[model samples]
Target: MTSLSTVLKESWGLVEDRQDRVAQHFYARLFLSDPQLRDLFPVQMDVQRGRLLGAIVSAVQNFDSPEDIDGYLRSLGRDHRKFHVTPEHYSQVKVALIDAIRAHAGERWNAVYEQAWNDVYDHIAAQMIAGAAEDTEPPYRHAEVIHHERRGADIAVFTCRPLQPLKFRAGQYVSLECHYQPRLWRTYSIANAPREDGTLEFHVRAAGGGWVSSALVRRLKAGDMLRIAAPMGSMTLDPQSRRDIVFVTGGTGLAPVKALLDELTRYNRTRFIHLFRGERQDDDFYDRRHLDEIAESCPWLTIVRAVSDEQGYPGERGAIPDVVSRHGPWRDHDFYVAGSGAMVNATLRRLTEMRIPSTRIKYDAFTDA
Candidate 1:
């Protein structure tokens, strides 16, 4: 078997020559050969194709050290598991990829190139299979949308069903695909616990000019079909731990934190939970009543609502981290922060400055862009 490093080094020139063509052909062959897989991809093949090729190029170019290369491969394995991509699908991809490379490389390509790619495919497929087995709750699209509600300017809540029963750790997100208009895809964290009932829910906030989000908020209605990728992300509650947990969220970031809170109660681990949520105003908050109810029922749970626009309500004001630092004990508890990239970064920076270890901080930064 050829070593991945050796193969990659030898095929550098060929990969460069055929990268774009290979990506185009890969999608063409995938859709042509397997229509079902086609539905799993974005409607705009050109955009997704560029992204796929760019990812591959970046991986290869960044293969400067063994550790970096191994980490990249591992991440690919993990992502493949999220999509439930099988070894057979990888095999199909390999066949099409090789053909694409050969077609683009022309006479310069030889038996060595074929051997190199074969080794690469085998390595990636083996890792993917192993990873899929290790993931106890692999991500998958649950079901189509049955109902939806527009609660705020850009916020919409959706009720859906999964194709299979989804058993997810709280705070995880599912990727959604919209068929109409811009026809792009994005991921939103689950806002509800894994109920005995067959329904799942998501709260989405439309960022202006956001392709899928704008469509879902303004145009999508009941009974419309949409595609959901499997649940993915590492944000969740730790059941085995006995320490108090603090959940801090901003804007639509409350979705995953809400799911985590629900799961904690469901498991009956009544650890102290301090939820500090920051939004523009009272009306900007989604599902505030439900959160209040959780706070009321669970003596260990405390809900703190913070508004940046301090007009009518006199509560904790300013940024979430500032509010948390002033009101809460920063040294003694586990923390989970979720929200936009700016919020996540701000919180992380403040926590670090407060001498909080990196291990205690877990966050789901909404990076849909």
Candidate 2:
């Protein structure tokens, strides 16, 4: 008998390249079946469209690793509470997803494949439902932008005060919705540890064709109201581990890493922390002064800044992975990495080559999609 993973992979391969078409078909069928569900998503559906495909692909790729993928799916499910998703919504999604895949697979689609998908999706939905039911926190919270500062041409630093205390670890991220963008939501890491005043900080860099990111960077300002969902992520520091730490980050990925470092400063006495921040150019290093101050006070902290694509640079130069590899023999240190998918993957690859155990490396790929 053919295994479910083999059948799912075979069927998915047929339609993976046509993801956009499949997504369009799925959403059309979904809304047609239940128009009320349309209001759950943003008016601009470009980014939202691809998310469905991405989720399915992730599940398919990790089908064999039930233990590992279950945690991620549950996390995804818990996070979906922000969208007001309920058990009924899962049924709708399952039907729409199966329909989309079947349509895209065409001649290759079979009852066997359909059943396999049903079983897998049912499991996914159940895990998600269980995750949602287990959480007692509110789906989302209202916040007021207390401060906003433009860092560069396309980046901004902002702070928001939640109407209620928004509890979260230093390295977690929360989905945010702005008044200007309505239902459109974007995920941003909190840039500080939990504070007495319940204020949260964020660093945003506008990307081309990014609706929410562009709005946050270019239009958001003080007094603006925003909605923030509960935090989600596991790249936080391990309190039990006494291992020294190395944080590798680039761009606005510095947010969560900075937060982790801030928390570390409060009680960290023995762990020597090395922070390697990379930017395309020197001017792009927006939070230099703040990081420098943190390093000054925290004698255990060392900050290294590297620049790529610039000439006559006074400091470290080259890609982040290359510069980071030079400072190691970091096999003994726990690694926390964040940045673009490319940067994260490259760093992971380099660390693996250095014989760093996979168990000691934690990374979060910062994507607004």
Candidate 3:
């Protein structure tokens, strides 16, 4: 018998090029079958359309790796609690997904592929349901903005206090929804560690078509309220490993990195930490003052500033990966990278080129809200 992964991958390849069409068909069928489900999504379907296909692609890509994919599915399942997704919804999605695949696969669709997809969807649904059930925290929290500061023309730094405690590791991220962008949720890293006052800090940049990010950066104020979902992601510190660390950050990617650093300052006594923050222009370096303050007090920490697309910069120049490369011999050190997809991909490529082991590297890449 052909393995489930093999069948799923082959079937996925058949419809991958027509992802948008598949997603559209799937959602259409989903909404038609159960019109009430339409209320769960945003008014604008553009970004939401991409997210559905993205999740499917991710699942298909890791089909062969049960352990790897199971963790992801569980986290996804837990996160979907914010949408109030039930097991019945999973069944509806599975039906729509299979229909979508069949519609797009045309003459290539087969019973083997259908059975494989059904089996895999069952597994995925089971895992997600289990994950959601295992989680004890609430699906979302109501948070009141306590502070908001515009750091640049496009960037804003804000802090919010959740009505209930939000337990999260320093390097994890949480999805947030605001009234201004109803039903649209955007993930942002918590810029601070778990605070005594139950405050969470986030740094956001308004991208061209990012509705939620625009609202966050431009319209959100001290009294505004945000609905934040449970924390997710695994790019966190390893308490067991005391390996010297290197952190690479670009743009507003500094949020999680700063959170990790803040946590490290409390308990890290030995690891020599190097933080390299890069920006396109000198003026875009927003968190230098706090970083400099930390570096001054912690002799174990070193800060390197880099500016690309700017001429005659006093500090290191060029892309973040290039700057990091110049300071290398980092093969023995654990690395954490956070940035835009392009930035993270570039850094990952550089790290791979330099023969850094995958186990030693952790990263989080964010898309526009």
Candidate 4:
């Protein structure tokens, strides 16, 4: 008897190489079946396709672990409410997904594989529905951008005051939709910890051609209102235990780390904290002044600046993995890593090599959002 995990893993390997085709075909089939569903998604399907495939693959990879499966599915389900995903859409998605796989997998996809995939999809959909049912608040809230700051060349810091109190943990991220781009939502880590007022902050890095990120950083101005979805992500620091904290942040990935640090400061817990912020050059350290101020205020905080790829940089220059290892034996510390997929994966690999317990590490990833 084959386990569900083995079935899903094996089938994933068959389709991993041609994921691009799988995503494209899946959307084509989905849109063809119901033209109305197409409006829910962004006009530009290229990026969304990859993200969809990646999300599905990630789900399958973690399905074997009961906790991973439950947590991820619940988050996905709850977050989908903001996208206005309905019960019927999940059914449509499963049909499109299975059809895409069947067409692409060809001879390799057997009845057993089909059954296993179907069962998994059924579980995913069920959990998603349960999650959606549990949420009662409005799908999203309105936030006015009261403050905007351009740091470095392309980093935009926006301070938004929500119409109502948007309760969220320090390290959680929020999906924001700019007026300029309707229905085109992007995920940005809330850069500040919970404040007394009804306000939240985000640090956005404008990539060369990223539509939302580019527009927010370059074109967005104060007084513009943006639609905000419920807060998502599980990056909160453990409040009960006063564990030493270690953070590895790449670029604007520092946002969540900053929030976590603020959380620590709020509690005034005398725990040791180390933050290694990596950038390309000294100028890339947009929050240097702020970080320095934080270190001054918090005696237990230590900041390590790592600059890579630039010559004669006036800071400790090396990749994140190298600079982190130089800091030496970081035993018995809760590690928080926020960065691109490559940065997080590489940092995790390096930390594991140092014999740190994998369970103790917490990750906050910044991707297209």
Q: Relative to the true structure, how large is the alpha-carbon lDDT of every model?
A: 0.74, 0.90, 0.91, 0.85
Q: On residues 255-364, what C-alpha lDDT tens digit does candidate 3 reach at each position?
A: 99999999999988889999999899999999788889999999999999999988988889999999999996898899999999999999999999999999999999
Per-model TM against the reference: 0.72, 0.97, 0.96, 0.95
Model 2 Cα lDDT, one tens digit per residue, 1-369? 877788888888889889889899999989999999999988878768887667776786568867777887787788899888989988998898889989988897889888988988888889989989898988899999999999999999999999988889999999999977888888899999998989999999998878889999999999999999989999898989999999999999999998998899889999999999988899999989989998999999999999998998999999999999999679799999999888999999999899999999999887766
Q: Itemize residue pairs with steric clashes in candidate 1.
A: 139-230, 140-230, 140-231, 141-229, 141-230, 142-162, 142-163, 143-161, 143-162
Better of 1 and 3 by lDDT: 3
How many clashing residue pairs, candidate 2? 0
Candidate 1: RMSD to truth: 6.0
Model 4 misses residue 46 by how many Å?
A: 3.1
Give the winner by lDDT.
Answer: 3
Off by over 4 Å in 1: 1-41, 45-50, 53-126, 129-142, 181-183, 267-270, 310-313
Better of 2 and 4 by lDDT: 2
**How good is model 3 by TM-score?**
0.96
Q: Which rank order by TM-score, best down to worst?
A: 2, 3, 4, 1
Q: How close is candidate 1 to the true structure, as a TM-score?
A: 0.72
Work out how many backbone clashes candidate 4 has: 0
Poorest 10 consecutive residues by lDDT, candidate 3: 53-62
Number of the top-ranking candidate, with TM-score as the measure = 2
Give lDDT for model 3: 0.91
Summed over model 1, clashes come to 9
